[model samples]
Target: MKKILLPTDFSENSWNAITYALQLFKNEECTFFLLNTFAPAVYQVEYLLVMPQPDETLNVYKESSLRNLEMLKERMQTEFSNPKHSIETISIFNTLVHQINEEIQDKSIDYIIMGTKGATGAREILFGSNTVFVLKKVKCPIIAVPETFTYESPHEILFPTDYGINYQDEHIQPLLNLTGNNVARINILHVDKGRGLTEYQERNKQQLESYFKHSAYLFHSVQNESVQEAIANFQLKVRVNLLVMLNNKHSFFENLFFKSTINQIGFHLNIPFFVIPTKLGKK
Candidate 1:
């Protein structure tokens, strides 16, 4: 059975993401872990050193987190009552990324479905701080749903790559799994910056082709435009439901996403984004 980890803050944005995940894998047998992490607003050294009393703020935060998770689970059961999906709730008094890593390891999570923005996310920002941190720090595959995006069949996928890192089977397995489950057409986009593909890039590109040989895909090239522009124009031309990328440090993923000013991004992402992590120069 597929084990999927979902971290929620009990916000509508998180709920929308959860619903999207359920519909995305409705036909498959899966276990969904709903996780909520809480920390005290004020850091007190004594809070950690001493045992928690009933009236302590730590207990209060823990109770609220557990209560909210249970409520969310009940709502999921009522709204998306799928027999193929089993729901589990987790409430921890830990940091978001830390607990997420723990759950991923303990539960053997396959994928993480989360909102691009959090409860306090700004509208102009493409991704919230938590989402960005996970995308960079966590190695597991993630599917980030836009807060306002409604669920749709991912029939068309847009994958933009610079072919900087070597391709691995496990690195591309998430994309493979999605394509295997859905009749999706992948549009492999390569943005040309006047410099043609190098010998190494050519070999990596060929490896990608071999990986997706069984899936329906087409190679697309755009010249004299930024990667952001190419992606925006491509989405305009084709009604893409999902956007995918391999988050390699050497790739364009960092330059396009890891800007100091989040709002400076040129394109507005409206579809679900699938991020597959790969180490730098991983063979």
Candidate 2:
């Protein structure tokens, strides 16, 4: 069964993602884990010294979280009736990024479906904060659904890579799984850094080409811009239905996503972004 982990703050944006996931995987038997992470509203060092029982203060918050989860589950069931799918809800008191990392490992989660607002106004300073954090740290594929993005079959997937990180079968498998035997086009985009490809980079690209030999795929190289700009421009030119990236630090994915100010980044991706963890690339 495909295991999907969805984190919700119970916002309408999150609900849109949850609904999208159900429809995306309607044909397959799947297990959905709805997760919520909460931290205390306030914390003081002096209070910790004087008040020994922190659990007492957290009890109320925990209770409220459980109630919210129950309500969310009921609403989802009523809206999307899939007999082959089972839904489970979990609430934990911890940081969102840490809890997500732990749960992915413990539950063997297959994909993480999240909603992204894409940094609005002051929020642009920290672009895709939670989504970026999990993208960097989690050990699974993450499908970031843009807020209010209606679901559609991914007929064209735009995947941007540098060939810096070695391509692994497991890392690419998720995309293949989503595409199945459908005649979907996989556009492998590589940004030329003016220095041209090293022998190692060329060989890695070849290996990647070999891996997707059976699928209808193309490799294109573009020059004279930042990796993010190249990708955004390519997406507009190709009219892609999905964006896929392998999250690796020091690579274009990290530079465009983690290192840049959220507002400055121009991907403004309206389609689903499939972020595959770098560790999953390990053989």
Clashes of each: 0, 1
Clashing pairs in 1: none
The local distance difference test score of each candidate is 0.85, 0.81
Model 2, TM vs. native: 0.88
List, residue by residue over 90-167, the lDDT tens digit for candidate 2. Answer: 898777877787787788888889998755765443335677677777677889998858887777889888898788
Compared with the true structure, the alpha-carbon lDDT of candidate 2 equals 0.81
lDDT of 1 by residue, 81-136 (tens): 99999999998776677678878777778899999763344456677788989888
Give the Å error, residue 216, model 1.
Answer: 0.5
Query: Which segments of candidate 2 are over 4 A away from where they belong?
Result: 43-54, 122-126, 181-183, 260-263, 281-283
For every candidate structure, what is the RMSD over all alpha carbons to the true structure, in angstroms? 3.2, 3.2
Q: Which model scores highest in lDDT?
A: 1
TM per model? 0.91, 0.88
Q: Give the winner by TM-score.
A: 1
